[model samples]
Structures are given as C-alpha cells and as structure tokens.
Target chain A: MKKTPLNQVHRELGARMVDFGGWDMPVQYSGVIEEHLAVRQAAGLFDVSHMGEVEVRGANALAFIQQLTINDAAKLVDGQVQYSAICYPEGGVVDDVTLYRFNGAHFLFCVNASNIEKDFAWMQQVLRESALTDVTLTNRSAEFAQIALQGPKSVAILAELTDVSLDDLAYYHFCEGAVAGEQMIISRTGYTGEAGFELYLPASAAVAVWQKLMAAGAPHGLLPIGLGARDTLRLEKGYALYGHELSRDISPLEAGLAWITKLDKDDFVGKAALVAQKAAGVPRRRVGLVMEERGIPREGYPLFAGEREVGFVTSGTMSPTLKLGIALALVEPAAAGLDGELEVAVRNRRMRARVVRPPFVK
Target chain B: MEFPEELKYTEEHEWVMVEEDLAVVGITDFAQDALGDVVFVELPEVGTVVEAGKAFGVVESVKAVSDIYAPVSGTIEEINDDLVDAPEIINTSPYEDGWMIKIRMADAADVDDLMDVEAYQALIAEES
Candidate 1:
C-alpha cells in the first residue's frame, strides 16, 4: 500500500493505522470521538497529502476547464477555488474536484486520491476527443502535500505561523503566501464545516509544515486527526464523498450537487444529459436521514416508507456532536423528496428514522 | 490490556468468567481498542438461545458495524442493557461494567475448551 509523507509521524503518535483506499493511513489518534470533539471544540490538524492534484496550464486553461468540468470556471478569478465535478457524457459523475484558478491561463485540479489515475486518464481522453492542442495536462499529485488546520481556534493557532492576510482570504479563495518560512498556497478552505485553512506545499515540506503546525497548535488543543474523524466531520456537514455520494453511475444532481452543475452554461460534458434529466425530473435524489430511534444506519441499508422501499444508505455514522445516528442516502425522488419519516433496515430489523436536511449538528 | 487470570478466553477475543453453571461474558480489552469509539451495541434479549461461533449481536463503532459472536452455546440469561445508551464503556471498562451478557451454559465443559489468561495473551500477541 502507498504511504503518505507523514506515515512515520502518525506511527510516532501511536495512531491506529488502517488500510484506506490502498493507502496505509491513520484511522484515528487518541480515539475517533475524542479527536472529532477536539476539532469541534478547539482545533485539529490533518495530513491531506494523499489527495491528488493535477495542473492544467496554457492559453485556453479556463475554456478547457469549462468544457471539462461541470462548474463554470469562467467565473473564477485568480487565486479562487470552485467546487466542481467532472461528469461522464451520460450525466453520471466521473469525479468531483476542487478547481483552483491561478489565472485565466493556469489552473489546478485537486482530486480524490483513489480516482487520481482515472481522473487524469479521463481528462486526457476528453482533451484528445475535443482536439484541443493549446491545453497542457500534468499530473502534479506527487509533487504536492497538503494539510488542513480546522476548527474554532484555527485562526488563533495559524496566526502564530503564517504572514498571510487570513481576513482577506475569503472562503473558497486562496493566495500564494509564505507560511513557516516556506512558500505555500494558503486557502481559506476545508472539508470540515468550520473556520480553517488548507495549506498546499511541496511534498518535501510536508513534515516540517506538519511538525510546525502541531507544535504551534499544541497549546490550543490541536489534535492530529485521522481518516475516521475526517469522514464523520465531512458527513456532519453533508459534504459528498466521491465514491459514496457521487460515483460513475451517480449524477451530480442526484447527489445534491445541482448548484455546481451549471446546466445553463455553454455546452460541456454531460450538460445535455443533465438538462434532459432535469427536464424529465431526476429519478433519484440524495437526502439526509437522522435516526429518530436507536439504530445506527449503515451503508447499503435499505430505506423504506411504509411497505415501499425508497432507497438505500450511501454513508452513515454516529455523530460525535449529536450523539445520534446520521446518514446520507440516495432515494426515489418521488418518495423521499420531502422531509418525512422513513425506516432504515439496520440489519434484521427496521429502525425508525426521519428525513432531515443536513448540517445535522447545527 | 488487562487479562484476569481466572477468566477463560475465546479466540474471537471474548472473555468468559464461569461461576457454577452461569458464565459472564464480555469483549477483551484488545477488541475494544481495535474497534475505536464504540457507539452502539446490540445484544441478544434474555432467554434467546445462542450457538457457539455464531454472531448473536452487533457492536457499532463510528465507522463500522461488527458482529459480537457467541463464544459458547447457551441461552442468554441476562444482558448489559446499560450498553444500549452508553456503549463507550466497552472502551473504558471492557471487563467490569462492560460485561455484555450472562449465559446459562448448555454444557459446562464448554469453558474447558477456552484458553486461560496466558494462552489468551499469547493468542492476542500472535494476532496483533
């Protein structure tokens, strides 16, 4: 299995290691709930170096990205980030990505780790079919390492290190700045729905940056979180994970990403199919479920309303903050479109659950 | 981490303490440590018959749902109902308050099939 640059550091911290997406990564440190609560109460630092990055540069970067992704890259100014998805021509999702626009001519695509190779190949295939000669595609995942410092105390802890104007760096915006004596892309962004920063640096700088942040954040109770808490934290915010929420057969609209699927824009991959799907009404919709009773809903668990099966759970977990089971499920739009009661088959028995909009904690 | 010498152990990491025909059962400290932040536990109801090596209940951590297997064939005489609402005790006190069930053993000789503290310790060492 592949290992990130901080594998040794995680081992040093005695984090329980697990195989995650073919990578040997820490699943927790101290414990999942404790580390999760720490992020909510104070601050938590995460090693996000395993996530992949692709650099797209040249004369027609914006146009190439606009055709390649679902979101409108034309709207992105320099040093701005846009949450986007690359879709199959048939309207299903190929990969969800975070597009960082350096300028009209240069851009970076931050993609999910497991889909790195596939995403690059797909992009290359699209560019080849489109016959765009001006665009350059480079997989830069191995060249970068990223870290996220998130929570209520994030600003205070990061203030002790970086010279960047965090105030000016609006959410979803980024800037090229010096942090801890190293040049890095300082972004006011994170997977956790909290005040945070994602620092993108050279792979070689990962250890120093992580060590420095851990030291600076120690007084503020910043814990080195692992993949387990990361899942719960993102689920708490209703963020769509690539494989779980959006997959090759799951469209962005069905995954509750209609806002990012710019159907009104000029022709892009999957736009025709998405527009047709919208016109015909989406067959299924992604919705949130909070257990009204005792059981913890798990992935692939069937959901029902009365005798009719509505859908199945994509991801579910016990919310560390709410102390209740919360889940994201894809269900028949006609049945689960409204906020109402549903039953989740936890195993042998059906458990009472209610459909609630996400951000389950707040 | 703690292995009481008087307790008999199963390879599945359950500890059984036999007193007369009745046995108190709970997961080992190693099991709870492996399943971090246990959030919910589902135990068989009283009077339910169980077979050895079969899954009778489930223990859920934040990220996974794992079955708790029966270590010996018997009927569940009593269960730790407190675990329904406070499952983290499995992590905090797996041996004491976290004891999962009491079984009226079908065959008292079943206890003899289990390993003692030293053997259980070696088993966990090999597995880990």
Candidate 2:
C-alpha cells in the first residue's frame, strides 16, 4: 500500500487507518462525528497528498485546456481557478478536476488520486490525436503534497503562520506565497463548503508545514480530520465525489454539473454526445433526499416514486450535524420536485424519504 | 477487551450471558471499540424466530454498517429499543445498557460451544 508523507504523523495521533484506493490513509483521528462537527463549528485540517497533479505549459496551453475540459478555460485570468470535467467521446465522464491558470501559457490540473494514470493517458491521447505540438503535459503527481485547511476559522488559524493578506485572496483564486517559511501555492478553495484554503507544497516540506499549521491551529480547537469525515462534510454540501457521483458510466449532465459543462463553448471532448443527450433531454437528475423515517439510506439502495423505480442512491449517511439520514440520489426528473415522498428500499424494508436539496445542515 | 469470565463469547464478537432459558446477548467491548461510535442499530422484533449462526440484526457506526449475528437458535423475547434512538450507548456501556436482545433459547447446550474469558482473550490477542 502507498503511504503519504504524513502516514507516521497520523499513526502517532492514533488515527484509525483504512485502505483508500490502495493508499493506507487515516479514516478518522478523534472519530468521524467529532471531526465532522468540529469542522462545521470551528476548523479542521486534511492531508490530500494522494491527489494527482499535472502541469501544462506552452503557448497553446489555453487552447489545449479549453479543448480538453468541459468548462471554458478562456474565461480565466491569471491566478484564477475553474472547476471542470473531462469526458469520453460517449459523454461519459473521464474525471472532474480543478483547473488552475497561472497565466495564459501556464496551467495545472488537479485530478483524483485513483484516476491519475488513466487521466494522464487520456490527455496524452487527446493531445496526440489533435496533434497540438505547442502543448506539453507533465505528470507532477510525485513532486508535491497537498493540505486543506477548512471551516470558518481557517483565515484566523492560517494567519498565525503566514504574512500573506487573507483579505485579498478571493474564492477560487491562488497565489504563490510562503507558508511556515516554505514557499508554496496557496489556493482559496476546498471540497467542504466552508471558507477554506488548499496549500500545495513540495513533498519534503509536508511534515514541517503540517506540524506548523497544527501548532498554530491548536488554540482554535482545530482538529486533524480524516477521509471518513471528509466524505460526510463534502456530502453535506452536495458536492459530488468521483467514483460515487461521477464516473465513466455517469455523465456531468446526469451528475448535475451542467453549470460547468459549457456545451456552447468551442468543440471539446464529448461535446457532440452531450449535445445529443441534452437534445434528447436528460434521463435522470441528481437530487438530495432526506430520510423521513428512522432507517439510514445507503449507496446502491433502490429509490421509488409510488411503485415505479425512479433511481438509486449514490451516496448517503446519517448526518452528524442533523442527526438524520441524508442522501444524494440520481432519480427521475418527476421525483426531483419535492412535492411528494419517495421510498428508499433499505434492505428488506421500504423507508420513507423526502426530496430535500442539499447543504442539509444549513 | 472485557470478555466476562462468567459469560460465553462467539468468534464473531458477540457475548452471551445465560439467564435460565433466556440468553442475554450483545456485542463485546472489543467489538464496540473497533466499530467506533454506534449511530444506528436494527434489532429483530419480539417473537421473531432466529437461527443460530445467522445474521438477525444490524449495527451501524458513522462509517460502516455491520451485521449482528445470533449466538444461539431461539425466539426473540425482547429488544433494546433505546438503541434505535441512542445507539452510542454501545460505545459507552456496551455490556449493560447496550445489550441488544434476550432470546428464549431453543437449546441451552449451545453455550457449551462458545469460548470462555481466557479463550476469547486469546482470540482477540491473535487478531490484534
């Protein structure tokens, strides 16, 4: 199993370890609910070093990125970031990624850890088929480590270590800055809906940076969170995960990512199929369902409107904040409207659930 | 970790305390510790017939859902209804208030096949 730079740090903290896509990672430190609630009310830090990074450069980087991702990279200015997706020609998703544009000629792609090799290969294939010799792609996954500091108190916690003015860093923007005496890329974006920052630094500097942040954040009740709470936190905001919500079999349209799909933009990978799919109308819509009964809805559980099968759950849990079961499900369009109840077949029992849009806590 | 000497234990981590023909059943301390915080529990209703070595209920932590197996064949006499609303009792008081069910045993001799405190401790030791 692969180990991140903070593996020993997590072990020393007595975190519960689990295998996540071949990486031996911490699933929880204090506990999932504790870490989750702490993040909601105060602050939390996360190790996201397992995610892959790809560097794109050359004069045609903007053109290549615009031609590759579903979102319009042409709309981005220097130091701006865009959330986008890469799709197969069939309109099935390749991966949803965060694209960072440092300049017109320099950009980077942060991709899911599990899809590193596949996403790189797909990009290489697209570059070759398009025969854009001005574009260059480098797999820099091993060169960097990533950390996320999230919640309402993040600005105060991070301010203790860095001189960078937090007031000027807008959401979805980044700057090259020194944190804890180490120069790194600090981006104001996170998977959690809370105001947060993601720090990208060299792999060797991870331990130092993590320790410094932990020490600075100690007085604020900031906890070192793990993958278990990460899932619940992101799910609470209705943010889609790669495998569960978006995958090769699921399209950006079906995953409710139409805002980033940019179908009207110049021809990109999978545009024709998406155009056709849109013309035929989307078959299903991703919606949030809150349990009206005691039973907890789990992934793969069937959902029904009356007696007709509408869809199935993609992700679910008993929200630590709400103390109620909430789920993101792909269901028929008619059921997306919360006018009536939907039944989730939880094992042998059919439990009552209602369509409630996400951000389930707030 | 507290596998009582007077109680019997199963390899699946369930504990059994025989009270005449009724066997008091619940998950062991080690099991609850491994499961972290218990968030939801589903127990069989009273009068349901259960077979030994079969899954009769479910226990869910925040991250996982696991099966609660029957230790001995019997009919359910009572269930811990408090667990449905306050499942964290399993983490705080796994042996007493966290007890899941009481079964009127179809055969009392079933306890003889289970491990004692010493044997259960050795089993968990090997696991850890």
Candidate 3:
C-alpha cells in the first residue's frame, strides 16, 4: 500500500486508517460526521497527495490534448483549468480529468488515483499516434504533495501563507506563487463543492506546510480531515467519483457531463459519437434519488419502477446534512422524469425514493 | 477498551450485562471504534425470540453495515429506541445508555460460552 507524505501526521492526529484505492490513508480523524460537518460549517484540511498529476508538454501540446480529450483544449486560457473526459474510440469514458493550461506548450492533467496507470498508458499510446514533437509525458505525482484547505474560512487561512492575494483568483482559476518560502501552485478548485484551495508543492515540504497550516488555522477550527468525510462531503455536493459515478461502460453524455464535452471543437476521440448522442438525446442518464422510507440505500442496490427493475444505484449513502438516504442511479430516460418517485431495494426492503436532480443533499 | 468484570462478551464484540434474570446487550467500545460512526441501527422487535450466537440486529456505519449478534438466547423485552434517531450514542457510550436490547434469558447455561473481561481482552490483543 502507498502512504502519503502526511501519513505520520494523520496517525498522530488519531485518524482512523483504511485502504483507499491502494493508499493507506486516513478515513477519519475525529469522526466522519464531525469532520464532514466541519467542512460545511467551518474549515477542514485534507492531504490529497494520492491524486495523480501527469505533465504533458511539447511543441504540439495543444494539438495532442485536443486529439486526446473529448473537450476542446484550445479554448482554455493559460492560467485556467477545464474539466474534460478522455474516452476510448467506442465512446466509453476512460477517465475524467482536469486539463490545466500552464502555457502554450505545456499542460498538466490531474486524474483519479485508481486510473493512473491505465490513463497514463492510454495517453502514451494516443500521444504516439500524433506528430507532436518530443511529447514529454512525465508522472510527477509522487514527487509533489497536495493539500486541500476547504470551507468558508479556507481563503483566510491560506491568505496568511502566500504573498499572492487570493482575492483575484476566481473559481476554477490557479496561481503559481510561493507559500512559506516554498514554491506552490494554488488552485481554487475543490471536490467538496465548497470555497477552498488545493495547494501543490514538493513532497519534501509537505509535512512542514501541513504543520504550519494546522497551527495557524487551529483557532479558527481547521481539522485534519480524512477520506471518510471526503466521500460524504463530495456526495453531498453531487460530485462524480471515478469508480462510482463513472466507468468504462459509462459515457460522458450519459453521466450528465456534456457541458465538459465540446463536440463543436475540431476533431477529438469519441467526439463524433458524443455529438451524435447529444443531438439524438441520450437514452439513459444518471440521476439522484432520495429515499422517503426508513432504510439507507447503498451502492449496487436495485431500483424499481413499480414491479420491474428500472436501474441500479451507482453510489448511495445516508446524507448527514439531510438526514435521509440518497443515491445516484443510472436509469432509462423515460423513467428519470422529475415528476414522480421510484422504489429502491435496500436489502430485503424497498424504500420509496423521488427522482431528483444530481445533488440530493445540495 | 473498557471491559466490565461482571459482563460477558461475544466473539463478535457484543457485551451482555446481567441484571437479575434479564441481560442488557450492546456492542463493545472496540467494535464501535472499529466501525467508526454508527449511522443507523436496526433493532429486533420487543417480543422477538433470538437464538444464542445468532444475529438479532444490524448496525450501519458510513462505510459498511454489520450484523449485531445475540450473546445468549432469549426474548427481547426492551430496546433503546433513542438509537434510531441518534446512532452516534453507540460510539459515545456503547456499554451504558447505548445498550441495544434487554433480553430475558431462556437458559443461563448459554452465558458460560461467553468470555469474561480477561478472556475478551486477551482475545482482542491476539486479533490486533
């Protein structure tokens, strides 16, 4: 199992450790509920170095990215990032990644940890097909450490560390600056659907920055959070995870990620099919369902419209904020209307659930 | 980690406290700690009869769900209904107010199979 740079710090804080996608990471520090509530009300710190960062830089970097991703990379500004879906030729999603336009000739793709090896290999194979010169693909994931300070007070805590004013950095924007004399890239992007910043720096300087943030932000109630709360928090905000909300069989259009898919852009992998799907309207879509009965719905549980099984849950959990069971399920578009409810089978019992939008808790 | 000397423990980490002829049962602190936060509790009905070493209830946490086994065979007399609304009490006080059910023991001989404080501690140490 892999351990992050802040593994020792997590242990010292009495975090409950669990194996998360082969990384021996903290599942919780105080508790899932408390840590989750803290991020919603105050601020929480997360060691997210487990996410993979791959650098793709060459003279034809823009051309390579345009061909490799389903979204148009040419539209992104130098300091901005765009969320895109990379796909196989058969129109199935390989991975959902954030394409950061560092410069004209350079870009960084932040991908899910579990899909790192597979995504890297796929990108390399695709890179080989293009005429991009010296398309230097480097995996600097292990060399850099990332910390996400999230919630309402995150900007205040991070503002004290860096000289660059965070006031100018809008949502989804990033700035390269120095924090505590160490070089860092601070992005205003987060998975928890809260105001926050993801700071990336050298692995050697990770622990020191963590300690500095904890000490400086302790008075404002910044807790060292874990993956358990991370899951619940993201679920509340309706964020899609790699294995749960996405898979090799799921397409970006079916997953409600068509906003990221720019079919109008010049040629890209799976663009033709995606544009066709968009034009024809996708038959199956991912939607949110909230249980009205007394049972907690879980992943892989069957969803029924009357007697016949219409769909199955991809990700489901009891919402801490709403005090109700909610799930994301892929159902036939005809059965996914906002006008009615469905039944979700939890174990032997079936619970009444309403088909809402993507975010049930939000 | 607290193990009352008079209480009996099951291998599944449930503890039974005998008061007269009735036994009040709940999961151990070690079990609650391992399970993290308890989100939902499915308690057996008040009049349901359960067999020794069999599941009588279920405890669902944020990540997974686990069956709560009966330490001894008996009819459930009472249950702590407060856990239905606030299951975190199990993590805060697993041995006391968080007691899951009260059962009238059908046979005292079933208690002999359970572990005492020392035996349970040793069992946990070995597993850890």
Candidate 4:
C-alpha cells in the first residue's frame, strides 16, 4: 500500500485508515459524520496526494492536448483549468481530467488515480500520431503531494501561510506562490461543494505545510477530514467519480457531462463521434433517485419499475444533509427522461424511489 | 478497543451481557470503531429466531456495509427501537445504549462457546 506524506499525521490524529484505490488513505478522523458536518459548516483539510498528476511539457503541448481530449484546449487561458473527458474512439470516456494550462508549453492533466497509466499511454499514442513536435509526458504522481483546504473558512486558514492573494483567484484558477518558504501551486478548486484551495507541492514541502496549516487552523475548527467525508461531500454535489459514475464504457453525453464537450473545436479525438451522437441524440442518461421508503440504496443494486429491471445504481448513499437515501443511476433514455417512481433492490427488499435531477443532497 | 470486563464476547466482536435467561446483545467498541460512523442499521425484528454465528443485522457506514453476527442462538425478544432514528448511538455508546437486541437463549450451554474478558482481549489482539 502506498502512503502519502501525511500518513503519520493521519495516524497521530487517530484516523481510521482504509485502502483507497492502491493508496492507504484515511477514511475518517474523528468520524465521517463529524468531519462531513465540519466541512459543510466550517472548514476541513484533506490529503489528496493520491490523485494522479501527469505533466505534459513541450512546444506542441497545447496542440497535443486539444487533439487528445473532447474539450477545447484552445479555450483555456494560462493559469486556468478546464474539466474535460478523454474518450475512446467510439466516444466512450476513458477518464475525466482537469487540464491545468500552467503556461503555453507546460500543461498538467490531473486525472483519477486509477486511470493514470491508461490515460498516460493513451496521450502518448495520440501524440505520436500527430505532427505536434517534441511533446514529453511525465508521471509525477509519486513526487508530489496535494492538499485541499475546503469550506467557508478556507481562505482565512490558507492566507496565513501563502503569499498568494487567494481572494483574487477565481474558481478553477491556479497560480504559483510560496508557502512557508516552499514554492507551490494553489488552485481555487475542490471536490467538496464548498469554496476552497487545493495546494500542490513536492512531498517534502507538503509535510511541513500540512503541519503548519493544521496548527494554524485548529482554533478555527478546521478538521482533518478523510475519504469518507470526501465521498459524501462530493456526492452531495453530484460530481462524477471515475469508477463510480464514470467508466470506459460510458460517454460524456450520457453521463451528464455534455457541457464539457466542444464540438466546434478544430478536430479533436472523439469529437466527430460525439458530434454524430449529438446529431442522433444520447441513448441512456444519468439521473438521481431519492428513496421514498426506509432503506438506503447502494451501488450495483438493480433498479426496478415494479417487476421490470430498468437499470442499475451506479453510486448511492444515505445523504447526511437530506437524511434520506439518494443514488445516481444509468437507465434507458425513456426511463431516465421521464418522471416516475422506481424501486431499488436493497438487501432483500425493494425501496421505493423517485427519479429526479442530480446533486441529491444539495 | 474497549472490552468490558463484565460482558462476554464473541470472536466476531459482539458483546453479550447475560441476565437470567435473557442476553443483551450489542457490538463491541472494536466493532463499532472498525465500522466508522453508523448511518443505518438493519436489526432483527422481535420474536425472530437467530442462529449462533449467523448474520442478524447489517451495519451501514459511509464506506461500506458490515454484517453483525449473533453470538449465541436464540429468539430475539426485543429490538432497540432508538437506533432506527439515530444510528450514531452505536458509535457513541456501542456497549450500553446501542444494545441491539435482547434474546432468549435456546440452550444455556451455548454461552460456553464465547470468551471471557481476558480471552476476548487476547483474541482481538491476535486478529489485529
């Protein structure tokens, strides 16, 4: 199991550890509910170094990225980040990535940890086919650590350590700055449905920054949260995780990520296929469900409309804020498009639910 | 992992406090801690027969769902109704207020299969 720079710090705080992908990460510190509520009401810190970072640097980096992803890379200004999906030739998503346009030549694609190798290889193969010159792809996941300080109180806590004026940095924007004498990239972005900053730095520098932030944010009720809260927080906002709501077999249009696809962009991979799909229309759609009955729905559970199997639950959980079971499911266009009652087979019983718009907890 | 000296334990991390022919069953501190924040718990209904070492309840957390096994075979005489509304009690007080069910023993000799305080502690340590 891989350990992050904050592994010992998590242990010292009595965090419950679990295997997240291949990394040994904390599931919770005080508890999931407590840490979750802390992030909603105040602030929370997270060790998100397990997320994979791939650096692409060369003269043709921008042109190369534009050809590989479904989103328009030309639309991104330097110091800005754009959410896009790398799709297979058939228009199915390989992985959802956040393209950080650090500069004209230097770019970084922050992808899901599990899809690092696959995306890296895909980009390399695609780059070789293009006339884009001197493109270099490097996986720097092991060398760096990323921490997210999230919630309404994030700016107050981060401002004390970093020289960067976080107030001016808009959402999805990043800039280089110094924190406790360590150079860092701070992005005003996060998975949680709250305002926060994601700090990216070398592993050694991250340890010191984490300790300093923890000590400084203690009086402000900044809890050191874990993946347990991270899931609940992101689920509340209906963010699609790579393996859960997203997969190699699903397309961005069907996954409710059509906003990120740019069809008008100068030819890109999967663009023609996606443009064809848009002309024809999507087949299946992702929708949210709220259990009208007692039981909480879970992933891989079969969805029923009375006795008929209509779809499968992709991701489901008991929403802490709503105090009800909610899930994201993929179903036929007719079944998902229409407003109707559905049932999820939970344990041995059927839970009555209603199909609604996503971001269930929100 | 706090194991009460007065309670008998199973290797599955369940604690049973025997009072006359009735046994008050609940999960141990180790079990609760391992399960994390309890979001929902599916408990056995009253008067339902349960077998020793069989799953009688489901403990749902944010990460995963875990099965709560019965220590000794018996009929569930009463179920803790409070947990349906507030399952977090299992995290706060697993051995006390979070007592899941009360069972009437089918055979008194079945308690012998369980471990005492010192033995249960040793068993937990071995597994850890």
Clash tally for model 3? 0
Candidate 3: list runs displaced more than 4 Å: A276-281
> Best by DockQ, which number?
1
Local accuracy of candidate 4 as per-residue lDDT tens digits, A1-362: 98999899899988878888888999888888789889988899999998889999988888899899888888889999988889887888889988899898999989887788888888888888886788899999888899999998888988888778889999999999997678988898999989998888999888799989898788889999999889888887888988878887788998989888888888888887888888898877888888898778888999987688888888888887887888888887777854688889988988899999877755
**TM-scores across all candidates?**
0.99, 0.98, 0.97, 0.96
RMSD of each: 0.9, 1.0, 1.5, 1.7
lDDT tens digits, residue span B1-128, model 3: 68788889999999999887798999998899899889999998899999998899999998788999999999999999999988889999998878999999999788889999999999999877
TM-score of chain A of 4: 0.96
Predict model 2's lDDT versus the native. Answer: 0.93
Candidate 3 local lDDT, A1-362, one digit each (tens): 99999999998998878898899999998988888888888899999999989998888888888999988888889889888889987678999998888898889999888888999999998888765676788888998899999998898888888888899998988989987778988898998888998888899999999999998788889898898889888887777888888888888888878788787888888877877777788878888888888778888999999998888988888888887887888898878998469999877778899988866655
What local lDDT score does residue A216 receive in model 4, on the 0 to 100 scale?
79
Please give, for every candidate in the order listed, the TM-score of chain B alone compared with the true chain B.
0.97, 0.98, 0.97, 0.96
What ranking of all candidate models by TM-score puts the best one first? Answer: 1, 2, 3, 4
Model 1 lDDT tens row, A62-84: 77888999998898989899999
> For model 4, how does the per-residue alpha-carbon lDDT over B43-76 read when each residue is reduced to its tens digit?
9889999999999999898768889899889999
CA lDDT, candidate 4, residue A312: 88
